[model samples]
Target: MRLGLHALGIGTGAEPAVIRAVAGAAERSGFATLWAGEHVVMVDESDSPYPYSDDGTIAVPADADWIDPMIGLAFAASATSRIGLATGVLLLPEHNPVIVAKQAGSLDKLSGGRFSIGIGIGWSREEFEALGIPFERRAARTADYVAAMRTIWRDDIASYTGEFTTFASIRVHPKPQQRRIPVLCGGNSDAALRRVAQWGDGWYGFNLRDVDDVAAKVATLRGLCEQVGRDPAELRLSVALREPRAPEAGRLAELGIDELVLVASPPQDPVAAAQWVTDLATDWQ
Candidate 1:
């Protein structure tokens, strides 16, 4: 499996110049991809249980400088040519699908087709409330949004009518360089696996604790693919490790992880963090 850097430290490491330095260094050092995630707004308190940690705590503080993943990726794309840019997982249900389709297509165009989308139905009820999106029925809404975006991406004069979003015949220009932007569904629940089997290009597992966790998930995914009549080999299986390094990275690869992304930071210092990640990335690749 290849190594990718999920820029989790950006909450603190986020100077414009610093991002450029780190992204440039990542490309120069041969890391395969650089990923960012999205959180447009945050509240001081939420009943939401964070799933990616041992104890369910949202890692980033309420006042963190979490930039829009797309914009950060745009900045990263400008700084580096070869490394892939992704939203590790964008909150798809909280925004307008048509506008997002346009933005993602534009980003792919700008990046020379190096953009991939990771998405989820999400767990934060308060976040859904803040966006005025209903927390219940999110799964159905997610499906509709994905279908609408696909229609926008795949059609010349696109029109889609769905329960959540509808549009008349309109031509959206500058289609993505790739035929379809890869959609990796995040979350490991049965519903998530079904979504991946039915509509996604891959599965994106987050904060997977170990190789055993990954293996069991992959096995379940394979069975889901069978039930859906989709070939398992056609899917991209990637995982995000919240820890800075996974000693079992190769072991996970052996169990069928195509890409393994590790959380990293120069959390306290940009230049120093940049150089630190730069040095580690050299050996990682």
Candidate 2:
């Protein structure tokens, strides 16, 4: 299985030197991808229940240094030629689809098609409210947004009509080097799994408990794929392991996962973070 590193564009990893060094080290050490996550803003206090933790609160402080994932990955791209750069999950419902498509296409073109997008219908109600976007029907919005983006990417004179977006006879330049930018949908809800079946090139599961959890979800995804007449094998499966019981890289591969992303707090310094990459790659092997 391929190994990836996450959180490279949050907190200390947001530093330019650190991102460059870690991305280079990961590439040199045979890591397949470098992942960054984003939250546009964090509220000091909110009723939003953090789904990944036992406690209903996120571990990140409101004032943590959070870089925009795309911008951070663009920096990483300048530093490394081979390692794949991806968003662990970009909150799709919070942004305008046309803008996202432009940014994504530009990045992909510059990066020589080494970029993939992992997107999610955001969970934090407060963040959505802060962005002046409605929290409800986010999944539908996500689907519509993705469709609109794909249309922009695929057609010279793109036109799309959807519930949340509409455009006509627009041409987006500098198309991605790849024919299609792989879209990995994030979340574990039935709705999410269905999105994986219907919309995603893959499913990206975060903070999953163990191999068993992955197995169950993969099975569900396979069933959903069949329901939609999509071949299960055609979809990539990536998981970020955060739980103590999370299995080793080999074990995750045995369960048909294409990639295993190790979620760890990256060091602040470039040298230290590069060493961190080498050490994790060594451990993974």
Candidate 3:
């Protein structure tokens, strides 16, 4: 099974020196990917319930610093040769699809086709309000945005007509080095499962409790794929463990997990943390 470390571009290691050091360490340690998650802004007090947690509150403090995921991945790209870079889950409907296509394409090209985007319809209504974007029908918006972005990447001169995006034939230069940059859909809802079967190249299920949880989700996803006439084996399946459960690695692999992501905290000693992770990976392998 492939191992991915989550937390390259957030919290303490978000700085240039730490980012470079950690990214290099991770790559040298044989990590398959480095994932960066994003939240453009957070409201101090909001009614939004954090879906990943049992409690209806977010783990991140409202005051936490959130660097842009693309910029963070760019930093990681410049530091590594073979390691993949990905957004854990960018809030898709908040930004313009055309701009996202350019950014994603540029990053993929510059990184030698090592970039993937994991996206979701955001949960924070207040955050959307702050950005002056409508929160309703966000799932539909995400679908349209992804479709539009794919068109931009695939065509020399692109044109797409979608509910949220519409453009005439126009040139968008510096297409991605990869024929298609992988789009990993993120979430655990039924809608999310359908989204994966319909449009996503992969499914990213985060904050899973254990191997059993992963198994259940995978089964659900398989059923959804069958309903849509999609081969479940054709899509990559990745999961982030909610808690450290090193012994479950083999079981996860048995269940067909492509990558296992571990949620990391801001380390006081980034080098030591990297070494610790490397040791854990070695043990798992």
Candidate 4:
């Protein structure tokens, strides 16, 4: 199994130089990928429940400057050649599909096909409101958006007429190096699993605490793939480890996990945090 690191909770105080240095170090340390997280805007701390945490609170610095993941990945792409770039979970329904497809294609082309898109429907209702997207019908909208993006990626001239999106025949140039850029869906719901089987090249397991659960989910995902007439082996299994434990690695591998990404905790010093990730990558290997 390949070991990767998720650059989460890393302070936003670091300068561009620090970001590039850390990303390059990760690449040199033989990490398979460098992943990052995103949250466009945070609402005032209220009763809004943070989905990842039990108490419904975000653990990271709310005042810390936020950077766009696409732009950050682009910077990382320029800094490293081997390490793949990914958005731990890009909220698809929150953005325009056309723009996203174009940007993603550009990144893939520029990165020499070393980009994997991990997407989700998003959990924050406040974020949806802030983006001016309705919370209702988000799942359907996300599905159509993904379908439209695939059309844009695969066709020389793409046109789509959907309930939420419509476009005429337009040529999307500078096609990606990969015929089909890998789409990895993240979520643990049954609907999320179905989406993975229907549209994703892989399924990303989030909030997964144990390997037995991962194995069972993999079985379900495989069954869904078979039901959809897709080859089960074509579906990759990746899991996000909220807390890294060495013993869990073997169990994850046994559960057929291809990649394991450990979330980073905030460090007192940004440089120290980056170095910590570098050390973890080296030690994990």
C-alpha positional error of residue 252 in candidate 1 after TM-score superposition, expressed in Å: 1.7
Candidate 2 residues lying further than 4 Å off, grouped into runs, are: 244-247
How far residue 143's Cα lies from its native spot in candidate 2, in Å, is 0.3
Pairwise TM-score winner, candidates 1 and 3: 3
Cα-lDDT of candidate 1: 0.82
Compared with the true structure, the alpha-carbon lDDT of candidate 3 equals 0.88
Off by over 4 Å in 4: 8-10, 46-48, 265-274
Off by over 4 Å in 1: 242-247, 267-269, 283-285
lDDT of 1 at 87: 83
Model 3, residue 198: displacement in angstroms?
0.9
Alpha carbon lDDT of each predicted model: 0.82, 0.87, 0.88, 0.79
Per-residue alpha-carbon lDDT of candidate 1 for residues 69-122, written as tens digits (9 for 90 to 100): 888898889988899888878989988999888889999999999999999888
Clash number for model 3? 0
Per-residue CA lDDT of candidate 3, range 1-285, in tens? 898988766677576767877788788888889999999989889899988888878888887777899999998899888999999999999999999999999999999999999999999999999999999999999999999999999999899998888998988868999958999999988889899999999988989877888899889889998998999999988899888577888899898899998777646476766666677568657
Residues 1-285, candidate 2: write the lDDT tens digits.
788889587778878888888889989999888889889989999899987776878888899889999999999899888889899899999999999998999889889899999999988999998899999999999999999999999998999999999999998887888847999999877888999999799989988877788888888998889998999888888898665233466677787899988888778877888898898888767
Clashing pairs in 3: none
TM-score of 2: 0.97
TM-score, per-candidate, Cα-based:
0.94, 0.97, 0.97, 0.91
